[model samples]
Target: MKLFECQNCGQPLYFENTVCESCGHRLGYIPDMNTVSALEPEGDQWRALASSGQLYRFCQNAELDACNWLIPSDHTETHCAACRHNRTIPNLADAENMARYRKLEMAKHHLFYTMIKLKLPLKNRIDDPQGGLAFDFLSDQVDANGNVTTVLTGHDEGLITINVAEADDAEREKRRTQMGEPYRTLLGHFRHEIGHYFWDKIVRDCGEEALEKCRAVFGDEREDYGQALQRHYNTGAPPDWQNNFVSTYATAHPWEDFAETWAHYLHIVDTLETARSFGIKVRPRIKLGHELEAQVDFDPHKANNIDELIENWLPLTYAVNALNRSMGQPDFYPFILSPAVIAKLGYMHELTH
Candidate 1:
């Protein structure tokens, strides 16, 4: 995510800010321009200072304080580009559910920001009912007898289901510990699941040629997915799994491998952009011949290759990890990037390009 400035006061701003801290101006994100604007009331509509002469309104979800995105006043759709893809939302009347849904929306909006910056294709279910992006934020169901049926978070075709409980910090941390995962978050979930959705569009539906290329990188996805997952859970990842897969769970199947790598790719580029926005640089004293020095002066989204991203990412991660250690926190990034992982990330770069 890029750093933003309040048009009214020129103060530094964040993507999710609904009001300017300095100038006390209302703020709304205009997706078409990829910037947040200070709004001026004009009858029932708002005039965006960042995009002059245009009238806009906040998404209908704004009524619930769940969205800050804006739609052009002339557009027919009331929902913003991001919220329009939501097929199902939790019961907002329940205060707990409403709070969880808010957290989910925050992460979902961050995911959409990266996708829009990358110029990825986005079609809501309304646009293509058979195969279009959609979200279902669901809670576990309970029977009259008090038997609970858990909702597993995963992607099916273009629909992504998120167990709303994942939005709770304690619940998510408990699951992360139980699963033995080094990293897990709502944004990571969104990125990983959307990776599967893109695979459908960029590989499976492309043709035999595209499928062959993807298979060469991610292995044969034709293998029985259920059996692969069952075996993974039964025996766990191989001893040397780190040499090949991005995460232990990635070893479950080829589809998972692709999604894990894809999520990491998104993590790298987006975090690097944030570093660049703040003009962050890492140049450690007594460095080993520029091995731990990086100047993020270019956009990662338009990086020439995966190697370019990795080169900067390593130094940044090292500095961040050290800072986290100083604060008695866990390592900011606990995963390793082996040579094999780099190669897979290269394939992801190619696919996105």
Candidate 2:
């Protein structure tokens, strides 16, 4: 989420920009350097101006307009680091599906950006078939009568399946309303599901001592997950659920709680980085006090601790939400993170550091 400018023209760039608007320079993201640069042709490969002396090629997915990640010319893998984790993709021949698939890739790439910046472990299924990160973007299930069946977006072990329909704004908004959820988006789904994948690696695979600590923070995940989820649906979260959980769904089970908190942690870190990139500062006037002022001059990904993250996050969210309200938009941050929730977030921070 850090600010990027085209190396050739200094045009402010976005994460997924395939071409520089200012100078019409072709762009590619260099994963190892975590940078996006204008490309200059160098025979079969291209030289990235931001990362000089290296020959690079866009991920093969780039041919389909689905990815902009770069792979070294010498690297054996054709897929970039992010696209290599794809276990399944929607039917690309269908124009609609192809569009949705592209949207999904955009979000997935952003997810990988944060993971890489945080230095989190990323082992794709190819690297560890038994337990490694992978994605499955699926179409809606259909019965013999051609009626839509069901396709739930979820994570099982290390594989994350996304119902491709989630990429459609209207469909996603409809579901959000039906589920009584405050927020829903393609990126949110990816962030939340990946939390499950990381839990497997950082907690489950870390041994009994680490697992015990996770349990202490998230509650006993040993509780019957199926039964708990059933109960949560039959009887919605307790009225006071906000006092403990980030979202109503988080109350379903300990695993959900961890994932919800993890998603929020990602949200906070990524947004804060964007704010820093733009040199955003919040200093409310009228003597509201220093608590409402925050200067994001440091890299949020390498924040000293969760407390530091939350300190800056609070003021930034406050300002952004107010700006959103000014524009007649919904609050940028609708859910409240209580003291208990903050403690859980701290544990999630500990998982990374």
Candidate 3:
């Protein structure tokens, strides 16, 4: 979520940009460098203008315009670090599926940006046979009458499955409303499910002490997941659910609580980084309390403590929500981070840090 620019031309580039319009330079993101740079044509490989004489090739997914990452010329892999994690993609022959897959890729790349920035371990399936990450972007199964059947978005072992239909705003909003969700998006789906994967990687394998600590914060994971979820659906969350859980659904199970908290932690950190990129400092005009003021001069990703992170994050979320309200739009962040939620988030911060 950090800011990016075309290294050759000093032109700002969005996360999804593949070209620098100001300089007519081909652009590609280098994950290792965490940069977008201009490229020059070499005899058989392209040389990155940022790193002279180093030959690189666009990721293979560039053929579909689904990626803008570059691979070192001598690298055996054709796909970039991010693309290699994908185990399956939707059927591109279907126009609708292709459109959805593109959206999925955009969100996935953004997710990878955060993971890389956080310096998290990202092993592909081939790298770690028992504990590795992969993704499967799939479309819903449709009946003869065109009704979508069993398409689930979840994480198992290490594979994160996403329903490509989440890309469609209408469909996504429909589901969100039906489920009484406060917020939902393709990127949110990725972050939430990937939380499950990390729970496996970090908590399950870390040791008994770490696992026991997690249980203390979230709840006992010994509950029957299927039955707990079914009961949760049949009977909604308790009236006091928000007192402890980050969201209503988090009350369903210990796993859901951890995943929801993890997703929110990612959301806050990544969005706070974007605010820092623009040198946004919030100082309310009114003689409001100092709590309304925040300056983001330091790297949020490296925030040494949860207090520092939350200090920057709260004011930024408040400022953005204010801006949205001025435009007659809903609050940018509708959920409240209660003290209990903050404690849970602190645990997550500690775990990742």
Candidate 4:
């Protein structure tokens, strides 16, 4: 994430900030500009400080202490861009639910940020003809209400259901260990689930020719998803899977492989952007987009055709891993991208432009 500043006082601000500490200015993110700015009171609502002509209202959920985004009060859609996608939210009165919901909201915001940056269309189920891009932050077995049971995070159609338990550190860690996965987080879950949403909306429904190319790279997605998931749990992933798959789950089906690769692409691009913002040099005179495209040329000893991104990412991940060790925490990034994975990433990069 990029560092934000208070427009009034030039004080450093975080993405989640509602009020600037130094200047006490009210802040709201402008999705159209991908910026956070101070807001000035305008009659019953607020106006962007940069341009008083543009008006916005703090999301109603924000007033209820559940959101931090802004919306045009007179607009037909009442919910803010991020909040509109919520299909189910836990009982707000419940304290545990409030905490978990907050974490889920944070992850959701990040997902929206990335999606907007990629220029992807984001329509909620309510607005779409086929119920695309919906979310369900649900209470599960871990937080059982003497009724419904939840096992894991998953995607159905365009609806992404995330178990609220994943927001709890201990609960999430237990599941992480149980699954033998190196890395797992709320943001990662959002990215992975959205991958499924995009795959259906963009790739599958694009055209038959595009679908054929998608199958060529990710494999035919005609396999019965439920059966594949059941077999994966019963027999586990095949041996020598690491040679071809990005994650064990990816081996379950072609749809999963695409989702896993899509999530990894988001991870790589976001981390590389963070590195760039921090003035951490990776490749000389090479831009981020160019460097990312060049990562397909895998040189074991050095990042040859790849620009500063992969070059900088290698050392950055190592340093982060070492830092986590020093703090007795797990490695931040716990997956390796093989040559085949790099090629997949290249394809994703190609799709972006």
Instruction: Compose the digit string of candidate 2's lDDT tens values, residues 48-146.
Output: 997758799889999999999999998899999999999999999999999999999999999999999889999999898999899999989788999
Which is the winner by lDDT between candidate 1 and candidate 3? 1
Q: How accurate is candidate 1 locally (lDDT)?
A: 0.95
Cα lDDT tens digits, model 4, 1-353, are 66677778888777788898887888988777777889888789898875557788877678666677887666866778999898888877889989888889988898787787877879888779485688888775534556656646788888888988899989988988999887889899999999998888788778998798888888889889889889999998999787788899888889899999899878876766655555553233345544423222221212232333455566667666767999999888887777787777666766654
By descending lDDT, how would the candidates be arranged?
Answer: 1, 2, 3, 4
Q: What is the C-alpha lDDT of each candidate?
A: 0.95, 0.92, 0.89, 0.77
lDDT of 1 by residue, 1-353 (tens): 89999988899999999999899999999998999889999999999999969899999999898899999999999899999999999999999999999999999999999999899989999999999999999999999999999999999989999999999999999999999998889999999999999999989999999999999988999999999999999999999999988899888999999999999999999999999999998999874847788999999999999999999999999999999999999899999999999999999998899
Kindly list the per-residue Cα lDDT of model 3 for residues 141-213, writing each as its tens digit. Answer: 8789988786799999999989888999999999999999989999999999999988988998899998999
Which is the leading candidate under lDDT? Answer: 1
TM-score result, candidate 3: 0.97
Residue 275 accuracy (lDDT) in model 1: 97
Clashes of 2: 0
Q: Between the candidate structures 3 and 4, which one is better when assessed by TM-score?
A: 3
TM-scores, one per candidate: 0.99, 0.98, 0.97, 0.87
| lDDT pick, better of 2 and 4 | 2
